[model samples]
Target: MSKPSLHQYYLSLIPNLVSELFFYIPKNEIRDDIIEKLDFLNTTNIFNTIYVVDYYKGPIEFKKGRDNTRLLLKDGDLDKNMFNLLEKKSEVPPHEFNYVLDKYFELAECLFYITNWMNTNINKMLPHDDTSSGIFYMQSLSYKKHFEILVKNFYPTKDIIPKGNFNALELIETYFPDIASQYHKPAHHPTEHTTPTPTNSVGVQEEIQPVLKKTKKPPLITALEAEKILLEQVFNVDFKKLK
Candidate 1:
């Protein structure tokens, strides 16, 4: 038999990568049919874990960019358009599978970095009274532009690959448009505190109330659910039956 080319070799690593990624999920609780379905997905040669890693870099960098926009030397430099390194396929020599494998692991770690960052940021955002309180209005536009590039340049899978019923990209797309909107939305600061209400006969001062303005709520995300969606969609493994 002919040896596997670099493309086929990195392609083969996906199933093992996915297995390790979701090792915490209990195996016995999964339905036999689901297990069979996953096995079939494992057989697919089209999808790669690299695509999953590429999808996450923008969202991760978006938060980082907004947090320290002034400090950054250039826009969107945090992740450095890491996905672009993988752009050339036909140009890479078949014997360079080891190089590709190294990059795969690096991007894999990046994916985890992004996931953990989102978990932290979402938790912090949830308790805030103003969902868009600390958001940098100008910086989020740059972030939105980066996100647009990611969506437009996404690599296509092989022609025979089946469309996944669930997709992580779709979830990210849904969550971030609202995020972009939230950041772009005007911040309403109270111009002045209302005049204190008159006290009765007593010497106590009445509380002052400020005018209220309606604000849009930030999208709520569960870390576990996000991780599950990424695993199932990126790896093409159906986990609907995993209790």
Candidate 2:
């Protein structure tokens, strides 16, 4: 049988990888709240658009060349619709916002490492132009802008107390030890931090539940779809070729 494409291989790995990284992030009240909010965001189509792509041309007129150079994250806007939703639902303190931002940064870094590994080992085997350069560049920009806005607004010139040491190898080892031992370099490490317990505010929960119930899709479906899109972008492989 022909071996799976580079995209297929990476796609198969992402859901577990993302889940592991997210879970391994040292738990704290702020992180918990962030997780809760993130969970809500994932339910919305706007979150998918933020990650996937946004249209450049709209009713608003744009300069001729500008329309073609559609940015992944336009004007450093991290989905204003989603942001507005978050604002309306939760009154997060600046410190907690900073805390959540730091944790989210850690998640982004973990994804970067995973993609970097794919580039080095797998992409090298494929045609040079077939490398995931363009896809990674755009996704990196999204990661940068999302975090940049958070830092500027919530923790400008502030020293963020890191919640814990993120030893990615160790995390993979703990959750998928055999996979880790085979694929990861040796080394790893968590601590719970004090933060406000989530009160499950009525507004956010109300918004979240309907979608979850309406779709009746399994929770893992989002992760699977996310993996499919990333793989398609990187390798132009059919999603069916994955998993």
Candidate 3:
């Protein structure tokens, strides 16, 4: 068989990388199917002991994006777009999802530090000298780049979630006159400094898009009602003199 290319070689390590990234889910809460898939990711069976954590369901609840697919990141950074798509594929509960994404966000930041990802200036702290944390930092960017390519290859669109008669692309085409221009992407994918344009399903520009159906659940977000109410009450007092 032909040898795996650099991208494919990194691609193969995802399950293991994810395995290393995530640790400590309570045994009772995890479903057998998810647990099974994750368990054998590195080893044959359940050899490692599952650690327990105090119950805390994470904040990234499922909501429908403008395209009506499961929305994982509402106001979260565009870097988190991958996690939004992952909600459908993994089908894990909110808490577990939060745990993994928290881990991912910390590591994924390596992609943005185009020049000094390793903080080599302060490398004197760690054990080694020349390689001093730079190798690990380089590896973080490498893994993040490959993961992006993998997501685009597999779950490239909201079409993966499959709503009723109409799909995400068709919905966008029918409504937005300028949609065609926004849909185009470059032929060559870059290894670093990639950014997603704002769009209906992209977790930005939420107000600009129209929703044909109700969201999966209202966004798991809340604003301070007291602020609104206080302002309205203050305004109302001035008008009380008229009555």
Candidate 4:
């Protein structure tokens, strides 16, 4: 049988794992398949960036481009609407956008690992003292720094706080009680508590029925919260459990 194209393999692995974790597929069965495919792609250098390709135009648009470019254009020239049709035609549900984003980060991690390994091994193959061209040195340094940051920030071990024995969510709850509570609460409904109708009473007008101005809340706990929670949980101390 013909080998699957790199893009096909990547596209296939992501949707399923994303579906499994987010779409409620059985974890036990899909877990192995997900890991295996992710590993295969990693080992084979299949994934780099999540690219939305236009088969008609034969170019791939990296998702990162969305942040800086106008919604209508990416790479300064390509029209984003062309891809809008593909997005519309795509079978993936809109709700699964988060899943796709998570998978993209996962794939980026795998790419970082593979790229780091390649850079290290290739350096070993070259003479130690070889003073290469400026472009080569620049590229090497750039990639090395990229991999270093990726490994440092997203390392699996780093995810475990106290350097190893704690859940990130629990840590956040412990360290940032206020922030965590805010995140859990439903979005503040502005319409539910608009300014009270301007009262014409000369007196205090019954205090104007204090408009229950929705309290502004932080979105999430910081990384430090994760660390604090890890310590508390591991020691079996009541370090502020999340509501």
Candidate numbers, best TM-score first, in rank order: 2, 1, 4, 3
Local distance difference test values of all predictions, in order: 0.35, 0.34, 0.31, 0.30
Which candidate achieves the best TM-score against the true structure?
Answer: 2
Q: Rank the candidates by lDDT, best first.
A: 1, 2, 3, 4
Give residue 191's lDDT in candidate 2 (0 to 100): 29
Q: After superposition, how far is residue 143 of candidate 4 from its true place, in Å?
A: 6.4
- Using all chains and alpha carbons, the TM-scores for the candidates as numbered come to 0.28, 0.29, 0.22, 0.23
The candidate that achieves the highest lDDT relative to the unseen native structure: 1
Q: Write the per-residue lDDT of candidate 4 for residues 137-220, one digit (tens) a residue.
A: 332233333323322222223222222222333423433233335446665662342222211211111122221235444433
- Candidate 3 lDDT over 1-243, as tens digits, reads 896443353334233333211111123333455434442322433222221111233212222221211122212323344544354335656655444443333333222221122232223323353332433344334343433333233323333322322232443333332433334555354333333443332211122434435454342111212211221222231222223
Off by over 4 Å in 4: 1-94, 126-243
lDDT of model 2 at position 227: 37
Tens-digit lDDT string for candidate 1 (81-177): 4233334334566446336634444334334433333333432433342323223222233333333333223322112112332233333334333
lDDT of 2 by residue, 76-162 (tens): 344452253246325556655445445444544344433333333333333343324444344444443333333333322222424
- For model 2, the stretches where C-alpha displacement exceeds 4 angstroms are 1-77, 80-90, 93-102, 112-126, 161-243
User: Which pairs of residues clash in candidate 4, taking residues 3 or more apart in a chain or in different chains?
Assistant: 171-225, 171-229, 172-225
lDDT of 2: 0.34
Model 1 off-target regions past 4 Å? 1-74, 86-90, 93-126, 129-132, 136-147, 156-223, 227-243
